[model samples]
Target: MNNSKNESVGCIVNECKFHSMGENYCTLNKIQVTKHETTAKDVQCTDCGSFVKR
Candidate 1:
């Protein structure tokens, strides 16, 4: 998680193991979004090849 507000806009699936869920709430970090999907943008996960829901 980033301390700077500007650096922490939201979570990104690339940083999370469970990003298939549309939940991006940052429980791990107060300022960060926990590295999960936060938008409808499509991202290709090479490890799982699963579509992330934003």
Candidate 2:
């Protein structure tokens, strides 16, 4: 597992396995980002495809 710190990659998903404890950051070296909508409209249309429920 690529358990590296990415200071710039902030995550608020506390239920995610990759979410750092007591912090707003992700421990994963990389994360898959995907579009939820058919057409690219706004930030809301995007989601973290790599989220794994803990």
Candidate 3:
């Protein structure tokens, strides 16, 4: 599916691998949006890469 014009979401990290360009994070840094398969839309965070989950 195509993301809506206003369907934008951001994260709190700047160096995240999932961080895409043109997206705005609520915080000052870049954040990655985690996708949840069973939920309504993207929701679950796969891995922080540099966190305990990694």
Candidate 3 residue spans exceeding 4 A from truth: 1-9, 25-54
Off by over 4 Å in 1: 1-9, 18-20, 30-54
Candidate 3 lowest-lDDT run of ten: 45-54
Best by TM-score: 2
> For each predicted model, how many residue pairs clash, with residues at least 3 apart or on different chains?
0, 0, 3
The residue-by-residue lDDT of candidate 1 on 1-54, one tens digit each, is 232223233445535443423455222323322323544244432223332333
Please estimate how well model 2 matches the true structure, expressed as its whole-model Cα lDDT. 0.85
Candidate 3, after superposition: displacement of residue 5 in Å? 11
TM-score (all chains, Cα) for each model: 0.19, 0.83, 0.24
**Candidates ranked by TM-score, best first?**
2, 3, 1
How many pairs of residues in model 1 come into backbone collision? Answer: 0
Q: Tell me the whole-model lDDT of each prediction, alpha carbons only.
A: 0.35, 0.85, 0.36
Per-residue lDDT tens digits of candidate 3, residues 1-54? 122222344444445433343463322133333544545443253533332111
Model 2: lowest-lDDT 10 consecutive positions: 1-10
In candidate 3, the residue pairs with backbone N, CA or C atoms under 3 Å apart (3 or more residues apart, or in different chains) clash, namely: 11-31, 13-30, 36-43
RMSD of each: 11.2, 1.4, 9.9
Q: What is the lDDT of residue 23 in candidate 3?
A: 68
Candidate 1: lDDT over CA atoms?
A: 0.35
